[model samples]
Target chain A: MIRDTIRPGTILRVLVLVALIAFLVAPERFAGLLAPLTTNNAPPIYNQGSLVDLTLSHLFTVAISTLAAAVVAVSLAVFVTRPAGREFLALSRAVVNIGQTFPPVAVLALSVPAMGFGEAPTRMALFLYGLLPIFENTLVGLSTLPPAVVEAASAMGMTGRQRLLKVELPLAMPLILEGLRLSAVIGLATATIGSTVAAKGLGEVIIAGLLSNNLAFIVQGGVITGVLAVLISDGFQAVARQAAKKSGTRPQTET
Target chain B: MTMLADAGPDEPAASWRIDRLGVVIALLLVVALALPFATFRATRIASGTGLLLHEALPAPAAAAAAAALVAALAGAVTLRRPALRLAAGVLALVALALGVGAAAAFLTPADNPYARIAPGSGFWVGVFAAAMLVTDAMVRLRLGPAGRLIALAMTAALIAALLASGAWSRLSLLAEYRSRADVFWREANTHVILAAGSLAAAVAVGLPLGILAHRVRRLRDPMINVLNVIQTIPSMALFGILIAPLGWIAANVPGAHALGIRGIGMAPAFLALFLYSLLPMVANTIVGLNGVSRAVVDAARGMGLTGLQRLFQVEMPLALPVILTGIRIVLVQNIGLATVAALIGGGGFGVFLFQGLGQTATDLILLGALPPVALAFAAAVVLDAVIEISGRGKP
Candidate 1:
């Protein structure tokens, strides 16, 4: 199972991590290094707030929305797949399609009128935007179950509920997780837009940079968000592979 | 457990009295009947938003809606025939129109010159319910491609006729559009240009990288991983990231500023969109090429076809449809995403969106938001047609 012991990717990733840590721990040291990118000695650090605060807020917004999206999407998928809820499948599909088609920025704009500003509208927009991927994957996962396995479960006199809970869900968990991973990554990126609506996240740093034409601020925000997204996405892929291994199936490398 | 097994197939029927669809329809009706249809605002963009205003429907509209809702409810409860379902769907659409018309007529009081009205939650619920009904009916009809196309064309024609009749002239969103029609068109053009430019770049870069990744196995994962990482960078952050390096290039390089590759504006916006689009395009190309059946490749080899010949004649033809599908996804995504380019002074309908946000003008925001959604949908449909044609050619 062991592949390359010393991957170029690994080296690049470590270098990035060290650089990021250095940037956060002692940003002033990089001031001289980034001076060329600045306009006539503009401050090299993003002074709006600490990078730590921005990162924490960014992660928090993404986490809340992604978790909410996953729960709702998975539940809706499960509901529609169930025999009693099958009649609503077309309607559910329509709902998700609407959600997917409507851009998140539009959602944010429309929602601001009703929900006001700050975190609430942003959360609502993020939650709606994240629904489609998770719902689609969960539907695929649940529907693609082996008929033989279901029959075998029934042959053991397992209840309908038990078969769904124990067999179908477990088998489908990996795909569902893939959906979650996608939603989270997307949420991670989209959450930055929340700053426009004054929701206080990493986007503030980026926006501030844009307004002031400060390259240092821009890079600082971009690097943090970029690194966080990459790490989270990779982490999710590893977890998905682990789930596939436990499920006793050859991992499908969709990611 | 035995009892559960015995009752499994029967349970669904026993509990199918109304079904989830019926519940949705019922809920929609209940909400429509209870809530306000519109909110009247004193000015275009003010914080002291007034109370939700309920207006009584005209007698004919009220009767029409009641009858339509009744028919829809009856259809939901008892109908199984496709024709009947379609009728119910049409009825729901009528109800929706009547409801909206009633709200539109009452939005600005006859004597009030400075007031604007926005659709309230109940109006949205009714619209969604009608849309769902129509979609469900379409599913029930199981129309072929031609039928669906005709339906779409007919709907478009109807909408065009309505616009021509100036039915929406009084609408706040339309009012907003009318005030700055030239700028609206300009923004729309810019939006299209940005999306198209980025899409072209994405294809140019992605196709080569995808081929290289496919050819060299070791390069596949890391390249794909890098692109995926690029995709996960927020659009704003990605745009921000491009600012510094591009600025440096523009500032330091000779004659680069003249070429317009600056920190802000179209340069950074296009670069960011291109970066975001790479993963889908590249991944699709790889998937398409790899999907070329091994048996067919073997046959090509056995026939003494050269590597390039086999790739062009065998793999390329087979992969074209999937590759196009990838392009469709990327194009649609870019259209939606290009709205953010407005933030960086890249120009687009997002100009209206941000302005609307700043001014607290909902109609102005919608003026920007609606076009990109429409554009994306159009791209999806047209690309789907292309995919269908290519697939048919294969067979």
Candidate 2:
């Protein structure tokens, strides 16, 4: 029965690995077929930078914003859960809700002028855009602990600080990790759009393709970005799974 | 807090005291009363336009002070439950109306017809603070979904009445829209078409895939991963990628080329948006279907019902709410993402948005950005109501 089951995930992984290796070892040999994807009067294939460099920049942009968002969101979540900070919970929630509601494009457009056209504005937009999911997830993680568990911790003479660090946070690790994963995955896609504001990433190739009507550049850019996003998401999902296993808590998938 | 606990029996002071949210209202009011309400600009663009000496017209200081006083009075209301709720709601609404009035009054003083008065930092902050205060009071009132809707409707009606009164005829955003009314309406129609078309396409593709994934255990993981991967591709990159294959097909295939599937335009934009919408729809459908109780399924089968009959009669009704929730997310998401289509010459409000960015015109950007936001928000609210109603109908 087990052998009868064709594991599509394994096959997909192997296929993707082979494709990545082929692309890296011989870019022309692998992605060369895409070169013909051009219309009449289209510009030559984008040669300003290699795929490897663009991938690095794309990952860099997404990573920085995701990290920044995670730090800020997790810290804010922790703060609002504290006794003195509890009153500000609704206010914080409202702020994050507004952040979620504002589209990334609007944020990018609004930010570009003040911050200038580069990774700075892109990072800012990504950070703001990614805050809500992480914050809300962390809030849910921290707040949903069983009352009896908390009472027991208090009864056992644990200090407030110790209880938070040793008990509550560890129990909430899987959920918090899930939030970070969500943020990182979202950041991956949003970072590409940053190219419109002159931020260096895979999006520049795509934008270049659009402007020049060159299918090759678009295909190449899209493939690299799509692959990177998949890999990044898989990596995060694996980490979340490990975290869940360690903490003995099933990770909730629904937002 | 301690004082309330320690109050003398003779003094019913606790019943007549202002709370923390009220204090925020008072503080914001004080800030507004002290600062300038708005700034007046000379032209739309041009850092150093001809003979330009930009004027920073002062606010209608008296009207602002009056608004602040009203806000403070609202915050101080401690008349106990029902009375307190009513008084605070009225006061917050009054404060909001006055804030708008103050802004209007600020614009009226601009004698130059060409002058544009932008809401100043003080006015913006005051309005936000007042809104937060009102939201807090609404929370205190413990309003249900229906009550909240009524409150929102009332606020909208009030704003419309204000607009009818010509209270904001000189507002910068409205003026920008007025100048491009024809183009704006056209773009708005295009945006709606793009959003709705993509949503319909997504539902068509996603619904069956979701069911297939749910039924086949092995297909579920890989299928979901593929959808998730698709979602992660930046919208711009996705649109870019589609242009190549789509453009190629349009060129080579006689049928496709005739159907308006060009390299850049609505085709690629719609395709990209359709891809983006699939994930949530598929995920939600699977979740909804899977959530149906095993016992209910057993009961349905025990009744000698066929697979299709059981699914239609029992499972679908139960899953409808979850499915609708998915549709809601997709609809709202598509609305926002459709704005990106403008980058590829796909007509939408994004024309104004990108143009505004290119020109560094904040008001113009707002003109494009606000409608999509309002659309997404309205879509979400309506969908939530649908989900709620569907949920309530289930046995």
Clashing pairs in 2: none
DockQ each: 0.47, 0.36
In model 1, which regions exceed 4 Å deviation?
A1-15, A18-22, B1-19, B47-57, B98-102, B298-309, B393-395
Question: Over the stretch A50-76, how does candidate 1's per-residue lDDT look in tens digits?
Answer: 877777887888898999999999998
**Poorest lDDT segment (10 consecutive residues) of candidate 2 chain B:** B1-10
**Second chain TM-score, each model:** 0.86, 0.84
lDDT tens per residue, model 2, A38-71: 5474544567777677777878887888888888
TM-score of 1: 0.90
Runs in model 2 lying further than 4 Å from the true structure: A1-31, A39-44, A49-57, A94-98, A112-117, B1-36, B47-61, B64-66, B69-114, B302-305, B393-395
Best by TM-score: 1
TM-score of the first chain alone, every candidate: 0.91, 0.89
